[model samples]
Target: MVKRFGRTSFTLSIAFAAVLSAAGAAVALPQLSNGWPYAPTPQHTDRTYTLAAVGDIACEPDTTENAGNPAQLKCGSASLGGMPAEFATARQADAMHPDLVALLGDEQYEVGKLNDFEQSFEQAWGGLKMMERPSPGNHEYYAYTKHGDNEAAQNGAGYFGYFNGHDQNGTPYPQGQAGNDTSDEQGWYSYDIGNWHVISLNAECRSAAFGNDCSTTGNGVLARETQWLAQDLHADHAACTVAYWHQPTFSATTSTADAPDPAAPGAGSPEGTAAQAWWKLLYNAHASLVLNGHEHVYARFRPMDPNGHFDPKNGIPQITVGTGGEDLDTVATSGGSYTNPNLVTAQDQAFGVMNLQLKPNGYTWDYRPVQAGPGFGSTALSYHDSGSGTCRG
Candidate 1:
């Protein structure tokens, strides 16, 4: 069922109240059925629909250093503790009335505590919570990794608590209700929107186990998720398909240098190699598109095959839209700075959202930068990029 919102606007005051409600105060969240992770009911007739996608959002105000900072809870300022980019993107997405919202990952910054998501993320995007189809990010599971042992933590309990909380019977999913074991391990699943088949996967392998590569690791959640992807793709007959996860298989920026054994937990480093295993599955299935978050910028690469070779006729295009609300990262300026030769468009300064108009045989994308507005920083109004492509399948 579609949810109704009585209030038509979001302000700092409302965000503060949301924080209090998250803390033990009585406040009812929007009603979501047991089938919280859902897709639009498939239609046989040819049609089109739009969805907003982005990630790396919501900053936590109550850091260890600022735990008792009263002013931080005010939610008045966009920069100090408040997430200006999150509010801007959420508000813009709400106005667009897209069929759904695809939150790539990093929904909450700096450890993804349940309270942080409620206060910061829900405060801005709560009105559309049920419309969210999300994948877990490094923030959600990094605490479970060796690199993030000391900082804020949750072991992903909070992330799952918010998304996979209750079923229609009011039974909590964490108790093994409905056999939904994917709740904690690797929240991977596939669904259909129009003629499109979409898959969301968990790529933060370090979160599940220490010293594990997300792409090539042969056991545990990564292995199971890879097996599941193969089965899901073989079963689906959609003409157009897209797969999304936290990290990108190909990043155009120099930020991702390969880590030397549990290196620092930073955004840009040589990473995403583990995702190559997943890429091969999608490629063999003739997938149409791939989406990711983590680079903290907006980048669109040319159509390429599973091995990162240009193959516009049968390869998949990947877009990194990690500029939701968190700080941005610079794209490599010099040629040969990155591995992927198909780097088409990349920008790091503006905060924005990527809109995809999915058709039966292809899709069109529009990256709309959120201009200066309440809770948003000053930025010129313009689209970073816009184009359409036919489905390779």
Candidate 2:
């Protein structure tokens, strides 16, 4: 049994109140099955869709270097009492029967070598690969190990090969579904689901494998991506749109100045900062939402503009669902108070997958923590956060 909440009505009431107050009219709202009043917008359609999203999943494969480390050994370890958290989340996501699975990135841990993805992530998430729309994370483009010390991995070659399909002749990099990362082609694309348009972007523009720069001024990889995005958005006519990648421009977790262990890589970090350009494009286009990972925690922020100020009417809300497994991180806090004011809610103690129900004119999100069996230890798997939001017209 999945948990449901009345927060959807609370959110809708706030939004509708502002609209109704401006119009100065007393219009009766139609009630939906979820108890929220429905107002049909331009994006209205009879059909609805569900998406399961998360990232930073799958542990490092058990190798000579990863042998004794419990973090790397827990991918599918039955000794941990029950199914590993990643596997549990996978099962939870499978149960939803989502129309699509958006993998925010870092699907494979450590260096994301093809062998590791095969040994670990494949066992846990391969079942959903057919419907998955994946993006690359920092781990996928790392030429060195996860510690940033050794150089034993291919830069995104493994990632490209896995999702894009490998060649029978045994090539280091295969170009197919994910596009050619080693060349000028890049790996950003968009598609439609019902009335919504979804985009998957590559955030590893600063990686040496790309152009080592995310500036949109020159003919760099990210610059081209920006150009493509502008064109993509300009051509899109969807009433609601969403763009997703790994890092976020407005992170929910801050540094030690605000919290203990920083779950995110700081909203001021280069990648996060560079992402503002993308946000500007999306915001200007009236995008509905932005999904991201790389934080190792679950956080949802109030709708805000590209500059990070609250903009409930036209701004885009960002949801960080990085809690797909791989040891969770602590949310930033000072004396038990959250650091980021825009953060609506955050949980760091449990691994979970976010189920997004995309309606015609709006959407509802549910963060379902993975339920652990008897052997899964004392993880707080009962934590939940859910709400609904209307799309910008």
Candidate 3:
């Protein structure tokens, strides 16, 4: 209700599913309570909430995989893209009165190498680097082609070394603190933010690549991540719930047969058979929304149950947020636009990040696309919706 026209921040107790997640130093979040550094609070009383999703923050890849090797690296294999833009996005989010960030995936380009931890992601998102409630994407898996063909390095390493993805509270995943029974680095995790509890899944399923998993050990990380997703979702009834990953479970963009070089659809394009089960899991749980990338363009799916169940009573909204610094992929449609009943809105022109204002009613999703030429930064795309809890009972 607050009609402030500038940046701001607020102080509120952020939380989760029947448990207390770790809390920050009680530092006042910018833009959520007070006016932005540029704007002063007006002597008026009003009610409001603001959250922004700064589209995609990543490097522009030359090939499909985009991850460059040490031999001939491009995009610096940076963790995230557009440092200044990311900073702006964070500031914009902070200023917009955000309770927490949604953290859409593909955090790092190329491989999930150790170097990117500092260079790519940390450098780009800045303070955002502190709280990473991440879902593992194909790229996050650091997946690599065993064949090692010409552009092999671009796919990144499917190494699956060791990772401990935390929730917004900064605690280890699966509800236990460092116990061997359920303790190990993993791709999927969950956390609670504000009145909502969220799960970050590792949808970058690459079990088929290795005899077991890409790792020298036959530990199937993809399966582990999937199991965790189910448990995470069932653990609570937060006012609202959502999940973030790297690949769109459903995107209108198709893999065009006639495109440039390796970027072609036949070989590798992102969406695979990995997420079918997870898709169903989401439908049953009725997650409020799902965020993903890897298609190079932005697309939003209509609210429907998984497998086209089309349960108007409770369907999740799926969105594709792939337009960061990466080049747009050839426009193709998995189905129709928003009018088609089966599919929602679809377009090739949209290229930017998403800005969201998370509220009790729902989070407002704004697609801000970048313009042609240079220095334009980002433009406001006229499309967004509220997905507070289509699945809430």
- Cα RMSD (Å) between model 3 and the true structure? 11.3
Candidate 3 overall lDDT versus native:
0.44
* lDDT head-to-head 2 vs 3, winner: 2
The best-first sequence of candidates by lDDT reads 2, 1, 3
lDDT of 1 at 178: 14
Question: What TM-score does candidate 2 reach?
Answer: 0.80
Better of 1 and 2 by TM-score: 2
How do the residues 145-175 of candidate 2 rate in per-residue lDDT, one tens digit apiece? 3433454545687788788767776454434
Q: After superposing candidate 1, which stretches have Cα over 4 Å from the reference?
A: 1-44, 63-81, 144-150, 166-172, 175-184, 209-217, 255-271, 335-340, 372-380
lDDT score, candidate 3, position 319: 74
Q: How well does each candidate superpose onto the true structure, as a TM-score?
A: 0.77, 0.80, 0.62
Per-candidate clashes come to 8, 0, 43
TM-score of 1: 0.77
Q: Give the lowest summed-lDDT range of ten residues in model 1.
A: 10-19
Model 3, 34-99: lDDT tens digits are 001122222211233344443345443344343433322345333223444344444544454543
- Cα deviation at 192, candidate 3, in Å, is 1.7
Q: If both were scored by lDDT, which would come out higher, candidate 1 or candidate 3? A: 1
Error of 2 at 120 (Å): 0.7
Q: Best-fitting candidate, measured by TM-score? A: 2
